[model samples]
Target: MTTLLALSDDFGSQLGKGIGAIALYAIVGLVLVLLGFYAIDWTTPGKLSDLVRTGKPNAVVVTSAGLISMAFIIVVAINNSDSDLTAGLITALVYGLVGIVVQVLAIRILEWATRIDIGTLIQSETYSPASLVVAAAHLALGLIIAVSIS
Candidate 1:
């Protein structure tokens, strides 16, 4: 009994530092995602004008999907922890929703100002598959963030 208690105590003592390290890794992962977003924004073939005119980009879809996934994983993973689950979940959801709305709204407003038909572009076969995949992945990430992190 004494040995078991001692072992547990030793493990507990080191747990905080280990967990903090893991949190750091998560932050790093987030930064990488952000960086990737920026990279695509600058390097992609389609012009911002094109996206605005059409209000449709596979990039938006891919990122949205990834974020959705993240929200779910983060929320569900942390529910039973000592963390303030409510605050975390709320913040993640709000951030994701705001991001999605902003992207969509920007596209819509731009298309409106340019007098372009967004619906037509969306229905076109020239839509990007790769960018859409990225958007889907982000949405999945967002879902994980919503459900698991809390």
Candidate 2:
């Protein structure tokens, strides 16, 4: 009975630690996603949340793509992190921030290389081909970063 009690306590402690790690990772992921959103918003003409509220398809597509890209990076970071909790959290945070910067740079590069007015394109009420292209680019960037880190 004493052995069983010890095992139970150990299991409970490990479970608690796992839960705490998950919560920390989740918070980091959310912050990264928000940063990605703001980065997209900064590149565009208007507030992304406002455009989302107004139900603009272009805005919706770009916003969704950006958030999804952030998620990809965060997921990959978490998956590839060290087993130690503190080390894992630090690794995820650094990777996530780097992912955001890479994504923003990709967007700027796309705009510069293609001569597409991304800000004007995203403001369109109707879906634009530019939006699709940008969305694809964002996803590709995410995958590329995720793979590189892994």
Candidate 3:
């Protein structure tokens, strides 16, 4: 029937749109994560990727925490975004950037308040207590930013 054909077309179109949205969000999320990683790298002494490749536990822990925090912000941004695709993408992007900035600020605050150089701590070969504290600060600030977006 023509009605059935039309229904199928409509469904297919909607499916395509949904897939497109997913791809867009995925790309955006990846970019945000990379940005967060670079932000951490910039604040630290050596390259984060190089440290990670050398099997440094402190570097790995700090990097993992930063990435996870970024993911939390992106997830919340996507969840709370507008129903409209363009609007939603814009909202997510803005919130994600804001989350990154806030996270960096949080790290700085922790370093100042605790009088521990997080960058130097993360460069250590062995895991340190300062690494744990930095990781916790990153996660807590990320959650706070994500919740504020919602």
Candidate 2 RMSD to the real structure: 3.0
Question: What TM-score against the true fold does each predicted structure earn?
Answer: 0.35, 0.89, 0.89
Query: lDDT per residue, candidate 3, 24-143, as tens digits?
Result: 999988898889889878877788899899988988888888888878888998888899999999999998888888888787777689887766776788878778777887888888
Q: Give the TM-score (vs. native) of candidate 1.
A: 0.35
Query: Higher TM-score: candidate 1 or 3?
Result: 3
The residue pairs in collision within model 3 are none
Off by over 4 Å in 2: 1-9
Tens-digit per-residue lDDT, 47-109, candidate 1: 433554565654345434544454344334334233453454455444544444444444334
Model 1 is weakest, by summed lDDT over 10 consecutive residues, at 73-82
For each candidate in the order shown, give its overall lDDT on alpha carbons.
0.46, 0.83, 0.84
Q: Output the worst ten-in-a-row residue range by lDDT, candidate 2.
A: 1-10
Clashing pairs in 2: none
